[model samples]
Target chain A: MHRRRFVTLCGGSVAMLAAGLRGVRAEPFVDFPKVRLVDAAGAPLKAAALATNDAYVFHYPLRSFPCFLINLRKPAGEPREMTSEALAYTWPGAVGTQKNIVSYSAVCTHELSYPSKEGSEIRYAAEASPLSGKPGMIVCCAHDSIFDPAAGAPRLHGEARDPLLPVRLEYDPAEDAIYATGLAGTWLLDRFLKSYRRQLIAEYGAGVYKEPVGATSAAVLLNTYSGGAVSTC
Target chain B: MSECINRRDFLKMGGAAVVGGAAVTAGCASAGPAAVSAGFKAALPRAKGPRLVIVGGGTSGLTIAKHAKKEYPKFDIVLVEKRDMYSSCFSSNLWYAGLINLEFLADHSFLDAARNNHYIYFNATATGLDRAGRKLITSEGEIDYDFLVVAPGISYDYNRIGVKDEDTIDALRTGYPGGFISPTEHVTIRRKVQEFEGGLFLQYVPNGNYRCLPGPYERACMIASHIKKNKLKGKVLVLDANPEITIKKDGFHAAFKELYNGIVEYKPGSAITGVDLAKKTVKTEFDSYRFEDASIYPGVRASTLIEHLGLMDAKSPQKEALISQLKYNYIGDERVYVTGDSRPHPYSKSANTANTEGRYVAKVLAARAQGKDITWYSPRTVCYSMVNANPPEAISVDAGYVLNKEGTAVGGFSPDTKLFEKRDAAKGRGTLEWARGMYRAMFEG
Candidate 1:
């Protein structure tokens, strides 16, 4: 019930401001207008109705950025402190009646390979994958990076040095709906934008890719979103 | 006017020093009359901090240049490269099968990488090194540095193929260029694949710890794909000097049987003894074969720059740099380092290995600059081989190295190493992205 309060109480804003003053290319944390999570039909999605087998893709904070919404079949872990090259912050625990829902930035911290329409180098494996050899792990086949989403999405193996950026979520019990509020590890977002600027511009029109997602953002299953081009490894 | 001494002249003066031992003697020879008059300094903005100079613009140098600045912002880095343009030696076989274009390998700009990471990209060929004086001699002029990294990659040893004479070696180099080093060779090999009509197209695999073990086998598959696509009567003759395929053997063998069938012929343990250029015939220990066209890959050694700069290990069979395996610093010298394929480690000579190793070496430089030290770690080698071109199926290997029992040098592959020898379309798709990710890591901030 008080999961979101932990982020502020941990002095995250102060740490972020300090990081900003260090002249790092990007801010450690970024806040965006709360966007209701809607299904393809533009209806707010119920948190309990979300699938427990695979991740759902949603554009959050920016039009080109992709995030993964997952239902951990079980209650998520407690809030914990995590550090990356960009900044240090507390990852708020999962939210919902059972506290079994979570989300993270799908872009890999290694080289920013994200789930695209053509195919996704990163995917959620409900069953054991050859690379991760464990279920409920996010695997990036491009360079064999694995992350455990249930445990704050810490890096489990391979070349990635940092965890997946956390996408803060809010669950309204009255409406049984979920919303995306803020993002941590914004430094990677800054890089993903600069590194793939040309392709993003070609896809979303010049400057449109960087525009903030409006009041509501659509969330779709990774399988449907990538057209079944997900890599198992 | 500044007196100029090129690499050729320096090599000529140090020819006897190589055999006589002690690189210090070679330095002594170059320090005579010319060293006093060599007053030119490379036109560069003065170093704002501890000047770090990196020689070579390949995967190793580029990654270190960018990451070193990130690890230690106080480091003012300079990357000195010979070529004005950038083209990757990795993933070059894909060009032969039309899976990728030249732009994919060459479109990354050195100038852009330097600008994005806050460093300087100086286009110059390193001619020599004055370790005591902390000066890097280049074609343009000299550069003073607090630290230096030399990563000049590899060179072909034609003598391993029994072609010791300069004339025959020249003939083989031009007539059957190995598509492993320069961009010109890649271009020539691609043209040969496109123009192949109907005969034996030879792809030779050299012995020893050569660069890109899967390269020759991968090229054979690409050429065989071309031959099969055009329904040409020619076959790709893979002349492997080893007893079996060096790496990812099952995947390549499967492709040879399932995909290429009659188009690819594999010959193992066929070390080339000589090449008769006039007759287009190659002689191995037990057999001689004729070919319509060929890419004669000879054994590899550290780049000739290593020996020319007097950094080569006198006892190293491959003429690699004489540096400490853990720190990559020259023995008894902390100011200088050697990395990349020129390293004596048995790790796969691959882009991925160098990229990861360069990042570690950058950390080493950053720590040493601060008068600190860190423990050593191994580099990872992630390599992919395209086995089929029509639908694009591939296999890959992810490996990490381990230290020896004495905790000294790289021993062999780590236990966590895994091989995806089962070729599939998913891996084929992964192969392309793997290269793109590598390019991004080396070229972007």
Candidate 2:
């Protein structure tokens, strides 16, 4: 165990931190303002209330950046270091009482395919997917890249060479609420923004896509968010 | 008087003769006219690092030009492509059925791709290669390179279809184009599909490991869909040379039977023995069939550029380059290489294969440039075939190759290769996204 220090930057909208962990390398972390996850009806989402069968989608850090909040149904493994083309960081493991709650960027690390209102190429497969052939895996059918969210979202198969970017989460036992505090491998966020500038502008306003999701962000079921057009592969 | 003409003057005369008789002499020679240089280096900025010159800016060259820079930042890359505009050949079939439009295939720009990836996009046709001097001679000028990759893709072998004379070859080339190589052919095919009135519209499938094994079948389905939608009195006859549907057979067969039962007719073991252009009929060994319109896809060989550059393997039935199947370098020369459909590999000659293989070759170039080496890894081919355009359904295959028992070259599909032959709307959506992902990988940073 080592001391982790956070240095506030950009007027608390963003912070730089040095991740001090056993296996994880020291890297600059992009800490966004903590946003409480709420359901579609503006009610605070309880960590324990989340269904283990399917994942939930939430906009965090920014209005356009989608993240997946999943309950593994079983305790997640120990904190592990993950590497991507963007950066290297430690997924601090699940944070619920049972240590079964985890979240990762919905963007496919392979080519940045993310969930939209119409459809999503990447989805959480609760059962064994034809592509992954394993339960509880995130499969990106765009190129058949599979990730195990229970174990730091490491890539298990296909063309992707990096693990899925992890989203940092904090649990409130008193309120039974969950908060997204920061994101690992934030460099990919810049890439996703640049690569999808036109589509994001159409989805969100011209520049509203990059606006920080101030205090609370709405979370919705993946099926509901993508209108049931999630690819199971 | 002839003796007084110096080698330079004689070469200039030869170049003029080639230009004058372009159509007649296009594919007749193994190489293009001798490299008549502009007598200067290409108008490019001085290389800040080791220059990597890649010819044929299709999927393979474009991918390598972008990725090689990422793998080794010290290497400067310049892509030499003949076409100023980029229209992909992979997803062109979707255009015939109006599932997608011309913009979908042609909207991608080479200038934008080069600017986004920090590479030079030199619009020039590669005419010859000076391997020893490390110079790639192009129509514009010569480019000096520390590393060179030629991924010119495939060319149609008219002789394979028994069309030996230049006149009939030209007639077939212009009248019923293959729709596999050029954007012009795609445009022509799209127009023919749109204007088709009735009768048999033949789609020929060539023999051997032709480019896009399932392309003709997919196109047949698209054309049949068009015919079905319009209630036209016609059928698309898929004259496949192979004994059966080459890939994703079950899906394509199901589409033919279930979706376009009356509109699409598939005939296997129907290799085109000869084409009588005047009669609009193609002859197999046992039978001759007449067609109202046809995309006469003859047998394919490596791009004539391979033979022009003298990198072709004489023993290769497809006239592919003589390169290491694993490393993609010339047999004896590491400075020069070939990839994409030009390489003598048994891999699928599709955009996905080229893109993945390009990334691997980029790593290989980076390692060799640094005086180091990396182990061989297989390139994955994730291909999607649209079987129905009415509701947009597709089948897909996710395949990875493995070396043979001898570990010498790519032998067959890996154990984990999976085929989704059950056509569904999900895979159909995946089909479009898959192509979009490929575009993002090649064109975006």
Candidate 3:
């Protein structure tokens, strides 16, 4: 049976599964204020303009993740399935007590991973856990690690051995949303790497298929975007 | 005509260089940032004061010294070298391809640029490093540093595969794409090429990790092209340890198929086991054959210096396990940095990466000059290979460039200037330009 499915058959909600896993989110992991704006440039960029910017649509890979920032005002509220590269994260500031409201990565620092977002927070669906005390936040579904978003580190639960790879965010009040300002350079899903390895092994287990990663080829991807991704077995 | 005049002037004035020393002045002139005018200029390092010791004086070592001094000129920059002169390994393909002369393209001394910076240059080999004491022990004497940069290039291990002693290795290096750094040995290479009759000329690639991944192929193409030009009947076999031929691989495959026509036999997944140098015979696990001349390109490991410093993963006696220990990021402490071909990195060990690593380490060292906390980033490189006079193809990659992963530059050849844009070097002028560029980028402004 598929690991995720077998776990579900054992009577666990998607929420509970997320709890068991790290780097995933169910809900209450992210907080979005009702405020709205057409656009904002607080972090040297207009938030609204960034949300719909064609540059973000494709070129987001330049930011080196599956990350994206949305403008609340212009947010189609359509629950847009993010097909872009940037793994959309909340803006990079805590407006007072709202520090834990945003979610981040929970992969190990030793290795980096590009885990996509499951809910409001970006989670390695294989290794799932919340950044703070919030439920449904996944550090990585592959490895259940937790990170503290407010503190920009790992929490007691989840892949606590690893920390959240923090992506810089900025809130543009004009757009009533946030924009991805910078990257920690290592905010990859360090936990999900195992799943990716497994997937590759399963797919190319003939042992003849050799795919070297994380450096030169990684350097190649750093220069441009390739629309293909190998699934984690 | 104008370009030729400039070359002639530079060469003729090359003698005046010892006297006039313009390259050094040009190197220092560009030290100040163009942004802040007077204050920045005043704050620049005064070409004298604190000893800025740079180990390895190759691309990275020299660049960091120059760039570091530019930011904090009050500090004295001292560059140390084991060799008498500095030449570039990048664009050295021209030498192997018979495209350029080694004398013209692969020679330069840092004395000119060192004088321009008023920086001290030491001609000595670094024997040991006391990272704690911040002192570099050289053959001449021990030199202390306020800050140090190490770019030791590559140290090849020919002894491991039974090519023991200098004479045997020297005989082997005759005409095979000779090793990088101290590139003066190519003079013997030309003789070996002329001596070879009709027999197999083998490029026996050692283990996987080596200085330049594309080097073997680039060398092969050059030899094959030369063989075709000479209308030779002998076959050139490339016994590779890797699964496929790399470094602008797709393009090389095409060229090999269409151009070489059967002169070059690419034997990937094959390696040489034993050699009877006296009998002029070599044996591989796949098959045994006799070759007139062979260039055994051996596997490269980290330097003894790096291992002694405990920079690598600690291994057990059986080599079964690695000790769980933290590795240093951004090259040891802020005091000392390693770049170029010395340190183990992900990218292909090429000249461009070395130059870029030199620039990056220098940039970080530069930030430290201004009382700023510097965050260092990994170096990037794009290699361009022209397979036997065809328009070159490229492979571009930048380490630590992306957020989660990395990528490559648009590859393949084109008449349009968008992709593979770096291939636009003037036919005759590329090697010299590359060497000059590395010097200017590293030594000068």
Candidate 4:
């Protein structure tokens, strides 16, 4: 049984499992209002900014997570079933609209290069989508590293030993705002977060509000965003 | 971290630490910010271990000083810098595009970095080097050292671009400031952007290996992003000396076309031959373009300080001074080590590379002091470029270098680097992380 599937069967929600595992150990975890999906100009990341298979690069100052929002609202033929928590983290493009908006960290586990930023597009389901090719795929140009975002951004190609990091997002129904809740992946971002916080405090003071909640446990982060919700093995 | 830890307190602490006694004390000085502006006293207490003097308290110099002090505190370390504050050339483009504030760009108290590391911080500009005597002559006075590290950074050749005569040079310096490496230069460029009310704004990218490879392109993207977001009238004319985009070509070009659209006018092979200060215009071989405001970057060379020390080989280009591949030491003198942008080593002149080499050099020096040998490790660099604002995508190139048996460093991905546009925003964010991490490792870590 897959670790994610086993956990999904045991816990009703992956977020619950993550919450239990990371609440104590996480280094300042981000939640609603604290983390907002913002575009390049620091505006709220919206559904309209992206189309089917298209991605919008989203980031907040002080956090070095190379994250992208994709509209997986409508799959090729049969819609792949996913849990609400997984959908909320990454699904459609629009918040609350269930536009099948999804987001993932583009930082390659191998060398930290974001493939999407270099004009590389995401891969969709083919006539017969491979297990690795299902969901969504991102390819790196440097060493041809492939990641399946739909299947928790698992490594499908190249030298990347681990799957692509997933960025967990929360959706607001009324405001149509997408808030980044947490992340599940490599520990490359913690150092960047510290630097960002220091600068923010130094320049803007403590009053300015731009806090990102970072997950402390690598296992918790990986399990939370793995295999569309948790299921017992 | 101290009760009376001001600039004067730092200098006093440094001096006392150098002397090494039960009590650390010094004369009282005014607590004004300009206290260190005048400069620290030339007379510093001698150290027990070998003294290492680092010129130019930038990434390379600071990194070496900090690492040396941390690893072996007994070793004496002194860092010399001309400016009181350092404005980083690494990510100043973020400031130009309004992504980050100028405060984020400028480091008013890099002296604090030295102080925290227990290294002597001298706020005096270096005037000349006495290689034979192992002494550095600064504005304050002469300071002797057992080992000297020259990392003064690069300088521009204004004469090469037909900016002859002091008046023309001065005009271009003030009017069209090339905000490449200097913090003051960044301020000049920032002000120009803020005050841009319309008309043409020209930014000419120089040819050859300059400070940061993606700097000019990133600046153009930032400027263009500002123009489009602010809804400013007119366009940003990016005139490049190279025939095409030197690095991250696809990403930058896509950014220009998809993000800024008509707001950015890019012209390749349009190198700046001459600048008319009176008219605020620049001329290329094919055509002459006028600008209301501009930042004309001429070709860069090693700091004149390296040349003055007679470190450069006669066969080397008049621009950069050549250094050994395995050891960053100059071929003529091993005691006087040279690294960073000033070195003629076949590596990209970048902050990342400098930061890596600084620590590496410090280790090498430490081993040498103990009569030990360490393997020569090659340097690595990662450069991130933010192409667009709204979509907020960023691309990057990570270069891992290896020195061949022939004593030449080879990076398969040279000026022909890789890119990552799809998750560019992530890369953009990574840029901040990388810059912060590198800067921290250099000064604070």
By DockQ, the better pick of 1 and 2 is 2
Model 1 residue A24 distance off true place after TM-score fit, in angstroms: 10
Model 4 docking tier (incorrect/acceptable/medium/high):
incorrect
Query: What docking tier does model 3 reach?
Result: incorrect
lDDT of 3 by residue, A44-144 (tens): 33332332111121112121224322221111211112111113332333321222223233223322333222111123222221122343223321212
Ranked by TM-score, the better of candidates 1 and 4 is: 1
Candidate 4 lDDT score at position A133: 32
Q: Kindly list the per-residue Cα lDDT of model 1 for residues B62-151, writing each as its tens digit.
A: 999988887888899999999999999999999999999999999999999888778899999888787778999888999999999999
TM-score of each: 0.91, 0.91, 0.52, 0.63
True-structure lDDT of candidate 1: 0.84
lDDT of 2 by residue, B242-344 (tens): 7778777778899999999889888999989898878999999999999999998897888988887887765566777777767888876899889998876
Q: Write candidate 3's Cα lDDT for B315-409 as tens digits.
A: 21110101111111222256655555544333346665566555555556656655665544444443445566443322221112221122221
Kindly list the per-residue Cα lDDT of model 4 for residues B123-235, writing each as its tens digit: 88777666666777788877878888888898887865777788888888877878876778888888988889888888888766667767888888888888888899978
* TM-scores of chain B, in order: 0.92, 0.92, 0.74, 0.86
How many Å off is the CA of A70 in candidate 2?
0.7
Off by over 4 Å in 4: A1-233, B1-41, B408-418
Return the clash pairs for model 1, or none: none
Q: Best by lDDT, which number? A: 1
In candidate 4 chain A, where is summed lDDT lowest over 10 consecutive residues?
Answer: A215-224
